[model samples]
Target: MPIPAMTEQSDPLCLSEVTAAALLFDAPWRRFGVVGDSLSAGVGDPTPGYTNKGWADRVANVLQRVCPDVQYLNTSEFGVTTARTVAHQLDRMAEFGPDLLHLPCGPNDILRRKPDFDEIEKTMRRMYDLAARTRALLTTFTLGRAYVVPTFPDWDERIRAMNAITRRLGAEYEAVVVDMWNHPVNDRDNLLSEDRIHFSTSGQAVMATEVVRQLVYMLSSRTSE
Candidate 1:
């Protein structure tokens, strides 16, 4: 049977509902792997773990409730740049062989005076390749202007530039782009931590919700196919 091409009138809710049911009814074993910087590591949202349990861990917990055999491995390092992430993290991520992968970095790279976008794009493409090799669904996110590091006067332009790169690379690599640049939650002050850089516990919950929805949609759609 041939798969039908999606039409503009297709109802996304229909697909999502179907997928959610499949997760509940026909649960499959899965593994979720993560790479990139602090956000992926769940920096501000402290949970009871040797490593701080962030959104990725939260995501894993949700999946486990549905599919008890779900495994998770996170290799995110705080302040790791995109290039270094590709160099150091991708190998470990591939070795873990995750069913889905999340990479959300760029703040560390863009916080500098000069950001090499071409290099960043190159690194993103390479990481996407690694995801393909491991057969993991790649998900990436854009940063919003909720917080600014101290003395980084031009933080606005830097975030915009980094988000642009994230959008571009995400599209190019066929990864799910969590559009935080336009997410309504970013407008609230309560979502950020004291450092003005990381998300508060509530914020990480929101982030985890977004990721879980995406995973459900993705996995359910695959099952439907």
Candidate 2:
């Protein structure tokens, strides 16, 4: 079946909605730190009617609204792999001493001709371990099914493996996992950017909304405990 077109108006979760969802968390985080690749950096093409900000920036914006003192730092670089993130970004994020941290996934790790799943997992574990040391509430996103690379016939399989690692580690570390593998947004024809890799700004908006929702759930679970 052909995918449907996604416009800014039709988006179920927009930046405004992200703001509303973030407000649901009464306790404000003082420091928000993000470290990883372009996804963590919120790199994507701007959709005509959507906000140009990436998911991290949008989330940070709403977070700042609730707590104007929130200090935001994003050390995400384009095309950086999991290993690179560990070697480079981890220490900086640690130094930032964030109370809320967004971890990177394994997208760049799976981009090569022969991705070593074991090594990818190892590096990812290292990142998670180090980030967890800060005692911050960790968060991550499982890659959406719409993020595809046609040149690689096994792209779906790679994404699945990477997402599995993400889910497993997220659970192990008690992180908020925003599972988007089967999201309806993935069925949108325009979900991807011109690079056919990253999601467009419309998708980013949806992601920000989901992140806030997950954070709210986490907070609620904590309150119930």
Candidate 3:
């Protein structure tokens, strides 16, 4: 069965009807790049045809529907940290020269036994600087919902601290920030997979919808200026 496209009328996690309409972009995107860890590599979506079809793929599909010329590339891997991404993924993502770059790291880093905040911030800044050099519309997100918070008693605090740094980095680097804490999708359940660590199929759809909405709004606003 084909996964249904997200529309405000049919969306389970709808923020508003008009929000979907706003995602209809006037100017098309050419190239889109994705960087991060397993989420970016699409770990939980499915292996329908032996390919990991996750949220990033869903977002790319939506972009291609409106802008067929858009090319997509994802350099994310499982268990990758901000430090590893800066060392391994940043240069390659910049080489892609995507019109828009979606970066979602820090999850893997924060999940570690001993996460170094200073190192995380520095590595993230390096990644941000590399993206800035490309002049691509760099975007990132925060984690406010974790299914396995109980497993790691201290994870909530670490996630909160990480989110703060993410917002600050977005502001300092002028990258687009997807504020998940304020997004309506958080109100919904069954979005996460059985493990609760990764997004479920439905969750992936919501995420893709959010990414498209933000990208369209950001691009349109820039064009108007």
Best by lDDT: 2
Runs of candidate 1 with Cα error greater than 4 angstroms are 1-29, 45-53, 219-225
The 10-residue segment of model 1 with minimum total lDDT is 8-17
The TM-scores of all predictions, comma-separated, are 0.79, 0.93, 0.83
Model 1 residue 89 lDDT score: 89
- lDDT comparing candidate 3 with the true structure: 0.72
Which candidate achieves the best TM-score against the true structure? Answer: 2
The lDDT per prediction is 0.70, 0.87, 0.72
What tens digits encode model 1's per-residue C-alpha lDDT throughout 143-166? 866857767777788788888877
Candidate 2 segments whose C-alpha is farther than 4 A from its true place: 1-10, 15-22
Root-mean-square deviation of every model: 10.0, 3.1, 4.9
In candidate 2, what are the lDDT values of residues 44-65, reduced to their tens digit? Answer: 9988778788999988888877
Following a full C-alpha superposition, what root-mean-square deviation does model 3 have from the true structure?
A: 4.9
Q: Which lDDT tens digits does candidate 3 get at residues 99-206?
A: 888887588878777788988898888888887888887888777464355667897788788889899999898787877755666555645666768766555666
Q: What order do you get sorting by TM-score, best first? A: 2, 3, 1
